[model samples]
Target: MNGIIGKKVGMTSIFDDAGRNVACTVVEAGPCVVTQVKTDDTDQYNSLQLAYGDKKEKSSTKQLVGHFSAAGTGPKSDVVEFRDMNLTKALGETVTVDEVFTEGDKIAAVGTSKGKGFQGVVKRHNFRGVNDATHGQHNRQRAPGSIGAASYPARVFKGMRMAGRDGGGRVTVKNLRVLKVFPERNLILVKGAIPGPKGGTVILHK
Candidate 1:
């Protein structure tokens, strides 16, 4: 597995070789430092721990500061691990977007989706909430009508879809094509939308 920590820079459109307009998400990927390298003999598994994005010294804990120092790097805001990487790298070495991915490569992006805060069933679960406004129905159009049966259940069952919080959860979008890679600026253009709000952290894996 090859992966790196990155930030979502937002979305844009580009023209492909055939002049077809393709919607793509711009990501500021990598220039990540290898903080740790786990081997099967030492860690019982093979994985590469990477760190990216600078963090203020006051905002980071002392332990984290020491950890980054041990790796010969400064404090980082994001840290992630990738297992089964093809190439071998030593600690403190940097990994860039162009090193792992290229144009037309299929990859997966993992990140937190945007928070919608408190939401109704109609918007949260796509419930058609009392479709008909007839039979003296007024403000109950967006209501979640009935939650449970009267006699048998007697209470709302677990895993029931109702009005509540929405979004702001880990989401993985797979099979996204790498539209372009700008190693000079450490940017990656992935075709299609990815999870998380603008400037939010994301992990791109292949």
Candidate 2:
């Protein structure tokens, strides 16, 4: 099908049988429980809600506890719904890493990028500032040069690139190769990096 909920378990480099080193990101994939199944007739769409990682009963909210109860599972620390899944023969059943993917499979990862807060035009938008650094340039060295023509429109256009927040948004990287799949440990090693920090949650799709 399309998806799996996984945890980023840091990165490592391993040598292949050919004695070539490969860089990979190890991820703890599944052993994920099917918490809820949404069907077209019943829920107006088709999807499966998978839950991973456990939490104390006391730490779970009533709604989450009830959701888990419906699935005959314990409270999970994370639950993500995957839509339009197929090639997954089991629903309301535990899905292990082996069932979803294998080595050398091509997949995509979606994650939130790391945040870079309150940056200037130079850093944020890559604007080239005043070139005359020696001729009394003063503070215009880092300033946004010309916002607009002097009097034509007389206003800065909307959607002009300016200093602001960067990152911390949904980013998808496509065509990443699966370097390894360890079903026993519920781990999958992708050939390259995914987004976000070390422990961020990422959704992998075929």
Candidate 3:
């Protein structure tokens, strides 16, 4: 997918052309610099590696410094690649939200969901616990009930759904329409809620 690495600037509402209020997520999409470009002849594939954000030179590792040095740019806080881009050039370039996308363009936003630590079966997997509270089930309110048929396999199945960790996983919201694009600020206002918290890194794909 052709896209930009951005930070979620939170969400707000804006009026459309017809004066209808539209809920949108504001993202600080790149003014991303082209750090490296892979070609079919050399790397056996085509891709453009983009670098964004700023990092302190003193704190950067040698490998990262080498990578940034190869780009002729200082060390960046983040780096991501857009594979098979439609550009003819190689490196030392910039791509903003305005260049590849515009208002009404269908897009997909990918981000990591908020972490919800060790949860119960009801909350994590939406499993219905013991429904009858009055039927001598004093301690069965949040219980997962019998895990399986007794002694059938003499052990819990490997793939059986149970309570554990939830959330904090990769999530993608697809077919999101771009409500507006601010070229000067390199911002993108996309329709609807995106995964992850405010100021979180998100990949906007088209």
Candidate 4:
């Protein structure tokens, strides 16, 4: 597996080979430092922990500072681990976009989706609600109609889709093609949209 840490720069449309415009998401990947290397003999797993972006020491805890210090790097904003990487890198080594991914390679993007805060069934769960205000249906357009039964099994079931907080959860968008890669700028344009807002950290794996 090959992966790198990146930030979502936003989305743009580019013309493809056949003169057709294609929508792609711009991501600023790597130059991520390997903070830790876990081995099966000690940690019981094989993975490389990579850190990207910069963080202030004043805002970071002592333990985190020491952790990054072992790698000979300053505090980083995003730290992620990957198993079975394509390369064997030592602590403090940098991982760039071209090393892990290339144009036309299929990859998966993992990140947290944009948080919509508290939401209603009409918007969150796509409930039709009361679409019309006909038969004394005042203010019922966005209301969730019924939630429970009359008797036996009177309580609402668990895992029942209802009005509540939405998004701000881990999301994985797979089978996305790598449209382009700019090594000098450390940018990768992946075909189609990925989760999260601009400047949010994203993980791309192939």
Which of 1 and 3 is ahead in lDDT?
1
- Among these predictions, the greatest lDDT belongs to 1
Q: Ranking under TM-score, best-scoring first?
A: 1, 4, 3, 2
Off by over 4 Å in 4: 131-138
Full-model lDDT for every candidate: 0.95, 0.86, 0.88, 0.94
Candidate 4 local lDDT, 1-206, one digit each (tens) = 78999999999999999999999999999989999998889799788999999999998999999999999999999998999887889989999999999899999999999999999998999998776688899898988888888896878989888889999999999999999999999999999999999999999998
- After superposing all C-alphas onto the true structure, candidate 1 shows an RMSD in angstroms of 1.2
Output the worst ten-in-a-row residue range by lDDT, candidate 1: 129-138
What is the per-residue lDDT of model 2 for residues 6-97, given as tens digits with 9 covering 90 to 100? Answer: 88888999998899998999888878899888888999988888988888999999998988987888899888888888745444589787
- Which window of ten consecutive residues has the lowest lDDT sum in model 3? 84-93
Residue lDDT tens for model 1, 122-194: 9999989776789788889999887899988788899999989999999999999999999999999999999
Query: Candidate 1: deviation at residue 6, Å?
Result: 0.7
Model 1: lDDT of residue 52: 95
lDDT of each residue in 41-85, candidate 3, tens digit only: 989999988888888999899999988888788999878888887
Against the true structure, what is each candidate's TM-score?
A: 0.96, 0.85, 0.93, 0.93
**What C-alpha RMSD separates each model from the true structure?**
1.2, 2.5, 1.6, 1.6
lDDT for predicted candidate 2 compared with the true structure: 0.86
